[model samples]
Target: MSVTSAATGSGPSRWRAGLGRLAAGAALITAVASLPWLSGNDPALTVLRARSADQDPTPEQLTAVREQLGLDEGPFAHLAHWLGGLPRGDAGTSWVSGDAVLPQVTGAFAVSLTLMLGALAVTVAVAALACVRTLYLGSRRRLQRGRGAIGVAVLAALPKFLLASLLATVYGVWLGWLPSSGWQGPASMVLPSLALGVPSGAVIGGLLQQSLPAAFNEPWARTWHAYGFARGRVARHALRRALAGVLPQLLPTVVGLVGGAVAVEKIFNVPGLGRLALDAAIAQDLPPLQTATLSLILLGVAAGLLIQALRRALLGPALRDGALPALHAPAAARGRFTRWVVAVCALALLAVITAGLLRDPLHVDTAARLLPPSAAHPLGTDALGRDLLARLGHGASRTVALALVVTAVCALTGLLLGMTAQIGAGLTEVVSTMPAVLAGLLTTAVTGPSAWGAALAVCLVGWTPYAAQAAALLEQERASGHMLASLSFGAGPGYLLRHHLLPAVLPGVLRNALLRLPTTVLVLASLGFLGLGEQPPTAEWGRLLSENQPYVELAPWTVLGPACALVLLSVLALNGADAVAVRRRPASARTRPWSRGTGLRVKSGVSAG
Candidate 1:
C-alpha cells in the first residue's frame, strides 16, 4: 500500500486518529494544569518562598496569599479557570513576580522561536551539506561509505551545552568575533544556533545519507536513468522520497532542539522560553511554568501535524502507487578499520574509568586549586581542589549506571508496547513531546530535585523513541514474505511471535538501546548541570562540567576532563551501534526478502503466480 494510504487510512479512520490526538492533547494539558494539586507542597508557601526567600510567613499571611492566588479553590476549579482564560489571552498571574503569565510566556516564546528558527535553518543547511556529495555521486555506494562519516558521528555526539561552552569560549572570550552570551542581534544568534543545530543536523544528515543511497538504488531511479532523465532531477526526486521516510524523525528533532535550548539558553544567557521554564521550575513558580509547558506542547503538536502534512505532500504520486521502498535499518559501512576504531574508543573509556576508581575524588587540597595536570593530579584539579581524575573516574560509574538503567527501562517498555501494539501513535507522539528537562521540572516540583528525580523524568519520556522504533520494525516484519507465508499456513500469533518476531525484532531493539545510551548519559548530565540531579560534592559528569564551566578560560583543564570524557562516551556508543549493525548485516541481508536481488525475485515470482 502507499505510504499515505497506510499512514492516514480511510477518511473515518483519519478523523478517529485526529480526535484521538486531540483527546490525548487535552488530557496532557489537564494533567499539566493540575500540577498545583499533584504537587503536595502548598502553593501559597511555595510562592511565598519563591517571592521572599528570607522571610517566613505566618498562617494569616499564607492564607492571604492563597486567597489572592486562587489557591483556596480546588485543583479542578483552578484548571477550569486557567482553561477558561486561555482563549481570552489570560494565562493567570505569576505568583512569584505578580505579573501576567501570558505576556511573559509570549515574550520568552518569541525569543525561543527566533532561536529555534535560526537553529532550524542551520539544521537544514548542515543536513544539505552533509548529503550533497551522496546526492551527486548517486549510486556510487563505495565512494559514499566513509567520506566524513567519523566527523559526522563525532558532531552528532557532541552535546549542546558542551558545544555552547566551547563556542562561547572561542568566539566570545578568545577571538572576540561575536558576542557569545545574550541575544543582541543577528551576530549574537550565530553561536547558539550552531551549538544547537550541529548535533541535530548531523543526526538528520546521517539518516538522510543512509536513506538517499537506498532511494537512488530503487528500480524506478534506474528506470529514469534508462529513460535519459537528468541526474539532478533524479536526485531531487530521490531526495523527496528519502525525506518522506525521514520526516517522522523531524518531530523529535524539532522538539529536542527546543528542549536542548534550555541549556543552550542558560549557557548563552538568552531569555528564551526554555530558560524561563527552567527558572520557573527552580523557583516553583507554577503559573508561568504551566503556561510555558502548555505552549511547548502546542508547539510540538503543531510541528508534528505540519511535518505529517509535509510527508504526505512529499509522498505525492507515491502515496497512491506505492512506489517507495519499505524502510529498514541502514547498513553500516563495514571494515576492519571500523572495528579498530571501536576497540580504541572502548579501551580509552575503560582506562578513564579504571584510573578514576583508584583515586580520591573527594580529596580536597586548598593549595592545589586549579592545578594543571601533574604526576599526582593526572587530569588536574578543579577550582575547589578536587582531583579531576578521581572525579571523572567516579563520575563515569554514576553517569553510565544511570544511563544504562534508563536505557534498559525505555527499551523494555518500548519493545513490549511496540510488539503488542498497545500504545497509540497519538499518545506516543504527545508523550515524546515532553523533554526530559521539562519533565525534570515537573518532577522537581513534586519530589524535589535529586538524582532519582532526574532518572524519573528521563524514564517518563525516553521510551517513546524506542517504542516508535519497535512499532515500525514490527510493521516492516509483518509485511515480509516469510511472515505472510507463516500466516497463510495458519501459524498462531503466539507461535509467530515466539519463533519469528522475537528473533527478528529483539536485536534491533537492543541495538537501539545501545545507540540511545549516549543520549541518556547526556540527558542525565544535563540534569546534573542544571542542578536538578546529584546535589553538590557528588561526582557526576554533568555536574562536573557545570561546576567547571565558569572557569573554562582561567583553567581550561578543569573542564577538559569531563568534556573529553563525554565526547569519548558518545563516540564509543555510536561506534558500538555501528559495529552491531555491521555484524548483523550479513544475516539480515540473506533473510530480508526486500533486499535488492531478493526483492526483484520475490516480485517476479508473485506476478508469475
Candidate 2:
C-alpha cells in the first residue's frame, strides 16, 4: 500500500498523491535555490555585499557587478538560468575566489561525507545496543528507566561544544594518549566521533524508554503472544512498526548535526565540511557557504526520505491490518523482552566505562610536537604537536567523558529544579517563562570559557524546559486517583512522590530529555566557535576551526572536517532518539485478551511499588 492509501484509507490513487507531494517538495527546493540569483539585487543582499567589500564602488560599478551576477535578468529568466545550470552539474562560480564552485564543493563533500558516515555508524551501533538492553534486560526496570531518563535529560541540557572541550581536556591534556588536532589520518577521527556519539546514545536510550512502554500496549504486540511467538520476535516486530513514526521527526536532528560538524571538525582539527562551512561563514565566502548549506539541506532530505521509506516498508502493512486482537502469553515470556533490553544496556554501559578507564597509557614526544600538515604530517600537528594520532586517542576519551558528565549534571539539575517548582508554584511561575537563549548567552558572558563555567551555564539555561515538563506532569498527577490513594495510605508528600508521582511522570521526563541533546550540542558548538569554550590552544571542534580562521580562504579543508564531524554526531544522536521514540510509541490496541476477559489472575497486590 502507498502512503496516501495508508493515510486516507482510499483506493488506488495513492501513488498519484505521493507523486504530488514529491513534486511540491522539489518545487520548493527549486524556488529557494534560485532566490539568491533572481533576487540578487534585493536591498539586503546588496547592503551585505557593500558592507563586506573592501572599497566602496560607484553606484554604476555596483549595478554592473549585480547585473553581471545575473541581477540584470528578470526573476523568471534568472531562475530558469539557475535551473538550467543544475542539469550540467554546475553549482555556479564563487563570487569571491572566481574558482569553479563544483570542484571545491566536491572535495570538501567527500571528506564531510566520510566523517558523517563513520560517526553515524558508531552512533547507530551504540544507540541500538543501549536501547535494546536497557528496555529488555535490566533487573530493575524502574531503576534503569529512571537513570536512563535522567541521563537523557542531562545530555539534552548540556552543550555539544562543552562536551567536546571537556573530552579534549581529560584525554588530550591530562593523559596525553592521542594527538591534539588536525584530521590528516585515521587517528584524527576518534575524538570527534566519540564526542558526536555519546550525547546521541543518551538520547536514543531515553527515547527507547518512552516509546517502548507504548509499544507494549500495541495490538500486534499483544497478538504475538496469542500466536506463541518468541518474546524477541514480538518485540522486534513492534519496534519495526514503531520506527515508521519516529524517523521523520529525526530529520531536523540530521540537519542540526551537520551544522555542528563545523565545530567538531574544528576542535579535533579534522578536515571535514563543517570546518569549511565555519570558515565560509566567518570569511563570508558565498561559494563554500552555499555548498555547505546545500549539502546539509540535501543530507537532511536524504535522511528524511530514508525514514519515510522505512516507515512505508514496515508500517504500511501493519496499519492495513488495523487494530490487533489480544493474545494470552505466559507472564515469563511477556517479561523476557524487557529483561534482555535491560541486561544489554547494563553490559554496554559497563563496557564503555571500562574502556574509558583502561584504554591506554600516554607516550609523548617533545621532538615531534607542532608539526605542520605535509608529507611528514598529513593532518599536521597541533600547537603542542605530540603526534595528532595520540592526541585523538586521548581526546576521544575526554570527549566521551565530557558528554557523559554534562548529560548527568543537566539531568540532575533539571529534575531537581522541575520537581521543586512543581511543589512550589511561585518558583514555577517565574522560571517557566525565562528564555533559554537569553539565559545561555548571559551565563556564558558571566562565566567566561572554562569547562565548569560552560556546564553551569548550560545547566542553568536548560533547566526551564525540564521544569515546565515536570510541572505539567505533576499537575496531572495531583488530580489523578493515585494522589488520593497515597493520601489514604497516610503516605507523606515525599513518600507519595517517590511511590506514585515519579512513575507517572517518568515517560515524559525521558522523552523530553532525549529530545534536548542535539539542541544542547548545537549551542555548545556555536559558543566554542565564538571563543566561549575551554581556553585557547585546547583542541575543540569549534576551537580548531577558530585556530584555522586565518587560512579558511586558502585552506578550507582545515575547518570543513571538524564542522562535518560535529554535525554528524548531533544528527546521529537525534536520529537514534527519533527511531527509538517511534518504535516505543503506542499503537492502537484493545486491552490484553486475558486482562479484558477475566481481569482475575493478576491480583492488585500493589497499585504501584
- Displacement of residue 373 (Cα, Å) in model 1 is 1.5
Q: Which ten residues in a row have the lowest lDDT in candidate 1?
A: 600-609
Model 1 per-residue lDDT tens digits across residues 38-134: 7777778877888888467899989988888777777678778877898898988887998899999999888888888889998998888878877
lDDT of 2 by residue, 1-609 (tens): 322233332564434434433443444334334434433335334434645653555777667666666555544664465456767888677655667877887777787676666666666666575567544642122222333443454454344544565566667666887655766766666677667766665555455544454455444455566677777776676566435434433443444444545556666776666666555543334445555556654564456446545655665544444321111111112234434544554454344334333423243456755555565444445444433333333344444456546665665665665564312222322222222222333344445456556556556545544554454344334443334443444556666565456654554555455466545544554555555555554544444545554444344444443444444444344434434433321111111111223432222221211
lDDT scores for all predictions?
A: 0.73, 0.48
Model 2 CA lDDT for position 210: 49
Each prediction's TM-score against the native? Answer: 0.87, 0.50
Q: Which one is best on TM-score?
A: 1
